[model samples]
Target: MKGTFPIEKFSHLSTPFYYYDTQLLRDTLFEINKEAGRHNFHVHYAVKANANNRILSIIRENGLGADCVSGGEIKAALKAGFPADKIVFAGVGKADWEINLGFDAGIFCFNVESVPELDVINELSAAKNMVAPIALRVNPNIDAHTHHYITTGLNENKFGISLSHLDQVLDHLSELKNIRLLGLHFHIGSQITDMDAFKSLCIRINEIQEHLYQRMLIVDIINVGGGLGVDYENPDRNSIPDFHHYFETFYKHLKLRPKQKLHFELGRAVVCQSGSLITKVLYVKEGVNKKFVIVDAGMTDLIRPALYQAYHKIENITSDKIEEEYDVVGPICESSDCFGKIVSLNQTQRGDIIALRSAGAYGEIMASQYNCRSLPKAYYSDDL
Candidate 1:
């Protein structure tokens, strides 16, 4: 299913902006809710993925919870209509003000990552004469088989409490009167395409659960943080991710106690395919050995390619000419500002509209004003 672009309408607008297929986004959310609803699972949309106001509004309308990692994200989720009770805050280094904000908002839970954070939250909750609900983010040490930078569940990663330190954390929990233990949270990594990695996590979680059971500490929630990957290379073919399989994986493998709720913090897989970075070809510079297709958008607009060496399918939507290989480079001073190498696109030329596919997740949210370039504005398909 090749995505349809309103080239006529796009021609009148400025280049280097984000284009979101709202219909596709709605469809994706529908599929996610349908599958998860069957098992009565809870999903929190990780706002770090894409915090666009419109995007957050649409997601809030779909009845999903919000997963925030910062004070700003918590506020954004609230402003976008997500219920405070349906929000969960998670981060390795949460400041005092951020913890106070979460407490003030009365979010569902704080995925506490360290003992110091737990102490701060307990102290803050006590200050307000409240009991802060929290879930210990346990590091299962399972490799998500993703980029090293994005992996969070490993033992060395500073994201979660290690198994070796779980007893100590539990001991500290007993002393915190204002902090209530709600459950356990585990996030292996992001961009995890392998289902077996998740299966392994379930097994690990079961083992951890057994240990907790032995200690007579039973939790009512089990939040397996989301890392479901999307089909970046073939977005049109697999626009909506395999939610059925993803949900079923947990249903089949995870050993949940009766009436215990399962939670997920999905970011990329939920919104990655519904948005694209639209850039106009500024110049087609031909070199002796290679051809460079320079575009106005650079690393400042979409940094995944340069930062993570990520791949996004680039298409010359404005041309119907014969295909040829061209290096898609951006107008940034940095040499790493390139999108792809030897990309196959229609015989490209200046003013050609290019669509960087599968960028809805980390694309716009991570945009920067580097080189003093203006941030990319976003337009929805319905609005266009």
Candidate 2:
């Protein structure tokens, strides 16, 4: 089934823009709160996904914390009115200025990825005569069974510290007077669908916790970074992710200490369903073997298809005729600018409106000015 779109309204606006269903966004956030609140789990919206100013404000209003990976993201979260105490800074390579920024703002904690990074944060904090709170990001080596580029939990990935070095890092933490180890963090990957992968992560974390317990070290937090996947093919069928099952997997498997808090950093699942890349068909070319529907929007606007070979449901929102197979492509100079090959859509015309479903996550945030094309403008449902 096709998603509901305001075809009349879309016709009046310029082509190649973004349209967000704000009501759907609110409903998704409500579901997240209701499910996570059941277990008293703290969730921080991953700011790397859809960092639009208005989107950030609405998410902040929903009472979700912010999980940022860069200094700019931290600034954006702070500007959106998220409390400093509710923001967590996380990244593999955080510059001195970024660490100072976190210390200045007094953010919750830093998810330190490496020993060198920890040392830098410690030195920077010591220079300011302040103690910095940190959580060690441990590499569990569990396979997320997703794409290689997004898989980060494995030892080969340069995201978190390896398990073999965890004990040494824990020992070294004592010497750094300016750094206080607050917790442990683990993130397998993004767009993970199998619950068993998370189940494995829980088991690994439990083992690590036991190891820490044996050393007489009990951290106050266990942050299992988010990798919840959404239904991209059937956005209408599943507007929201299976949060109950996702949270329950961790709750049932992960064992926590007394007064210990469980944190999550969710990005895609929170906003993927509420957005669509609205583009107009600039031309319909008839090929010898197949027809092509060329769109005005290119990789400059939405690069997921070309970048990750990702799939987004393509719908001719303005058509009511029979379905036909057509290769939907963009006007970008690169040959990889194809959105979908042999995509079946209703009989499309040169000016028919097309909606690329489930693009709220990494869509607009990853858009580039390649080919010197202008960035796409975003319009919300309420504003319309």
lDDT of 2 by residue, 246-279 (tens): 9999899999999999999999999999999999
Query: Per-residue CA lDDT of candidate 1, range 1-384, in tens?
Result: 346899999999998999999999999999999999999999999999999999999999999999999999999999999999999999998999998998888899999999999998888899999999999999999999899999999998989999999999999899999999999999999998889999999999999999999999899999999999999999999999999999999999999988899999999988999999999999999899999999999999999999999999999998989999999999999999999999999999999999999999999999999988899999999988
In Å, residue 332's CA in model 2 sits off its true spot by 0.7
Q: What root-mean-square deviation over C-alphas does model 2 reach?
A: 0.7
Clash tally, candidates in order: 0, 0
Q: Each prediction's Cα lDDT score? A: 0.95, 0.95
Regions of model 2 farther than 4 Å from truth: none
Task: Assess every candidate by TM-score.
Answer: 0.99, 0.99
